[model samples]
Target: MNELPSRAHRPVRVLRVLASRHADSTRMVRPQDFDTELVAQAASVSDVDGHERYVPLCVDWRDARLLLSRWDDDCAMSDVPFLYQRQRRTATHLLAVPFEQLDAPGRAARMTPTFIFSIGRCGSTLLSRLLAAVGEQSVSEPDVLTSVAHFDDDAERAAAQGARERIVQSCVAAFEPACGPAPVIKLRARCNRAIDVFLNAMPHARYVFMCRDRDDWVRSSSRAFGDSGEALAELLKASVEAFDRMHAARVDPVLVWYEDLLADPVRALRRILLARDDLDARRAAVERALRTDAQEGSGLSRASLAMRTGDAGALAAFGARWREIRPERLLREHGLSRLR
Candidate 1:
């Protein structure tokens, strides 16, 4: 097991380690999960800007509140590729806000965010970094959003659909003030499951879909997450369903291919930015982003995966399985034929 960072408070560090060790557990985080002493010791704030500084660490739907932790000033949320990891290592002061408190009149008018959605192992993180480099405040995969996406109880999820939508809006709204007028947020790949929730919550927000070729995606996912072929197939099917839902909602999201991004990132950035000017700055930003590994130092980093050997047999088996189960018609219908 890896050693816990010394910077994190001892109780939070222990809890994080325990959570990581029990990664397969379906348990939801509750107020009781944290040390009461630590929670009491942490400073509390009621204003919106305070909430912005203390990003939503996780959502406690059963309790109808969010667990927020103050972010370190030294590292901007956009600069940290993995939000959860950073929080785990650095969070000290914690705050809990009720769902209703997040709601305010005219809150919706305050900011409009740009969302980057993707299949995992794609270049969405790189896109985020490039946007940040070009002076766009961007957050890559905040855990609060992931908690909502992976909310496991079917009955609770259905019952709290409206609340969930509000929670999504509130969280994004909290991020906007600190992130600038037009903030860019890159969500975890599995967030495709709750794309509808986001669409309904932030109707004015622009959406971008980042994707990779089918074979390469499977290989990358296997290498990174060790997901089986069947799992990858399910993810693809879910993405297809999400795309269909977006179209039904009358949203025409900008599509960005991972292959094209690698081939000519400046062109890709230009398309996503929808800007004809600033070519020189965009080129410099892309070049800087390309030199750095977007996910470096995190669990999903290539360096971490380098310790484990890739299985060729598993890759071949996944290929065969995917070819048999691929959503061929849906792929073509949704302009995702290249993925097939």
Candidate 2:
């Protein structure tokens, strides 16, 4: 004879039980899939029907947009376990709405996001990963910003600013719900070229520029760039100069060095998090980032190895002509770097 369970006990038992559903693979998502409450966030620009269109990367948190970049096509049913923890649902197929279909009201309500721009082969990726440990949705090296930075004309750049803001607003609506109220985006290093143009669009956005020791950067970049190593160094130098100028002018930007991050990543990250006012979970996130191999699969690490071992290919790429570009006058004026 078995005792009858109470209503509460039955519900608990039911929750503990596992069941599977046969989701229809052929089911098409209609316009009804999205609405003002459920809007798509701009993940990337794609070609649809021979015209450039915005694609939804993830769903906004109000109803939860599927983060497309995190989804794997082979495992269509898989969801980011960290995300949608309560829902237990994964987006098997994505539904992208026209740019005009995105919820305008939602975009206006989103928080301003942070930006991370760095010299090539710096610790930008590692910083992004560390930020993720703290539950921040970090997008590392997005191509969209790089493309936006290519517009050189002042008028054209000004025009692009509006479009850029709209895209960012959509991205914020989509990613912030999952990453944090303020999502952090790490743009391609080249975006440094158009930093002002970008900042104009999102005037209040927080930004950080990462750099490395001159010798270290030169050695690392030379390995891959060959004859262009000097040019790469010049670019890095220019970026640092521009960043220093901004800092001197009272622009709210932070300058981070590769050496400092490597020596004490937790401390380094804490500085940025504190500056950004996102220090919640700093202790646990720093611990997790430090406990794990932060530089796993990092191309920068590989380049450093090549430089140390004196690989012939690396030597050839780096070439024999190593030139030390002058640090920006602003850096010297501000006493920013120890590199002489």
Candidate 3:
């Protein structure tokens, strides 16, 4: 089991698990107090008003400790072994997300390595390395979160390939002994469900949320966005809405800014480390240099020379064209403020 690195959350408490029930055509095993507002959506099969019930079943020490995107995803019932398939699919993704995908699978370390994430170019990779340096364990990038965030459900058997359940269980398996022995996990932003999973499953975990100035973030992301990549722009707009909801919900998230973390990694990380009592005496420079021996280890870089100096100034022009942009529509669809 992973060791507890710092003073963190409590252990996983097994709530009651439910068994199978009837639904349109599927089955799910739900936990006792599963609480995601989103009802389990029906499969893509048309004309299906209800899904076959897949009742929630046993809560393994593993499942009880992993991060779940939404508790409700665990609640449906079906004979199709959807949950098992979900876990398998997640495993595939965990093995293939940009950096983490490259790691040799099933390595036998005493503890599981840290899996770091964020949407593309969100500096999650950099943060992962930082944690890796500080701890004895290695770090992987974009694990389950990115794959799920960018999942193409239209692709056949996406969930089955991902193995959603086992992947989550694996993370907790890694986290437990790692936290106890060397305190490895120091991951950054995952989709909302990732957060839900961590909070529900890993009580001894400390989650970190890294943020950037909206304008800078937008402009920075626009750097490599292709003409057809309007989804990139929409993602930023959508995140703003999500952030607002999280803030209103009064979640006490640890906020780390991209600029601050980059400008003076030593000092910034010192403060972050000092937030934990056991880490107060940890030197900033030592912490900064721990896993990340030097700059540019995170594999992040500016856009290609062509994109950086392209004749088309469309990205830069977003600054001046805000009013002309249909930001209102974007925010409305994303359930966010009309700050645009």
Candidate 4:
């Protein structure tokens, strides 16, 4: 029999090495856990604009598994899964695998994760939760993307490109299904201002822009924010502004109404997912989500908001500003031209 090739000459299994090293425990990050030379980088970052940034991350090439670590100064890592956290007290020899090293292109080549941009107080959380039930990965609110969206200057723009890869890695790490689509990233309402920034980075990425009907939106928002005049105005402005930017960027997003989704969750989800072949594979997961009752769990559901009659009054107060912004384009984009 021919002699086997020397281990040194053989292809290095990067992902397997990282996973095996860290399999024993989840504790302090270990340098040896990563093939640093392959792609040496840090996983720690400070909070950006009061939002927690993702800790440094990398991908293991051997098994193609993603890895991340809790940074000493990063508070955002506190809420992440226990494996990613640094448990200083325990005498565990947890090796921190550098997840940032493996920023290889097309890691999630089969599926392009969807982006869900919504008006606040809509049923986005519920929709995200439902998607999760159907084997879809959903990152509801992350700090890194928010910071990336605001990038305008040269340095910030370059940084946004790197940040985009890391964000994709984070989603890769969060994804658990053996063979499903990429994760859905649901942006906070505030990020609506920089929606184009994100779209520019992932040009082919599909998106869904969700909103409640004007009346329901005003009512729900007023209940959430008591002094609702300015806030309500901003909400409407952002909703319209997002569409304008989408049109300018030529980012065609499917518009979903909260009430319509509630009425028929299955069909609504299918309409959104069926937009792409990869997403269509999640049919079973969608079925499971349909059966799931909305409740106060996993930060997905909240007690239903009571309709506030004062919503009409609040809208009246912002009448001038509201009229100044043209909503006809948005109305037509979502097939609500009849409203226009």
lDDT of each: 0.71, 0.50, 0.36, 0.51
Residue 137 CA displacement from its true place in model 4, Å: 2.1
TM-score between candidate 3 and the true structure: 0.46
Looking at model 1, which ten-residue stretch has the lowest summed lDDT? 9-18
Clashes (N, CA, C under 3 Å) per candidate: 0, 7, 62, 9
Of 2 and 3, the candidate ranking higher by lDDT: 2
Ordering by lDDT: 1, 4, 2, 3
Per-residue alpha-carbon lDDT of model 4 for 66-113, expressed as tens digits? 333333343222122221223222212222333343333355444576
Candidate with maximal lDDT: 1
Give the runs in model 3 whose Cα sits over 4 Å from its true position.
Answer: 1-122, 136-138, 155-166, 175-204, 224-229, 244-251, 263-267, 274-340
Cα lDDT, model 1, residue 298: 77
| Cα distance off (Å), candidate 1, residue 125 | 0.9
Output the better candidate (3/4) by lDDT: 4
What RMSD, rounded to one decimal, does every model reach? 7.5, 15.1, 16.4, 12.3
**lDDT of residue 37 for candidate 4:** 24
Please identify which of the two predictions, 1 or 3, would achieve the higher lDDT against the true structure: 1
TM-score of every candidate relative to the true structure? 0.84, 0.58, 0.46, 0.56
Pairs that collide in candidate 1 are none
- True-structure RMSD for candidate 1: 7.5
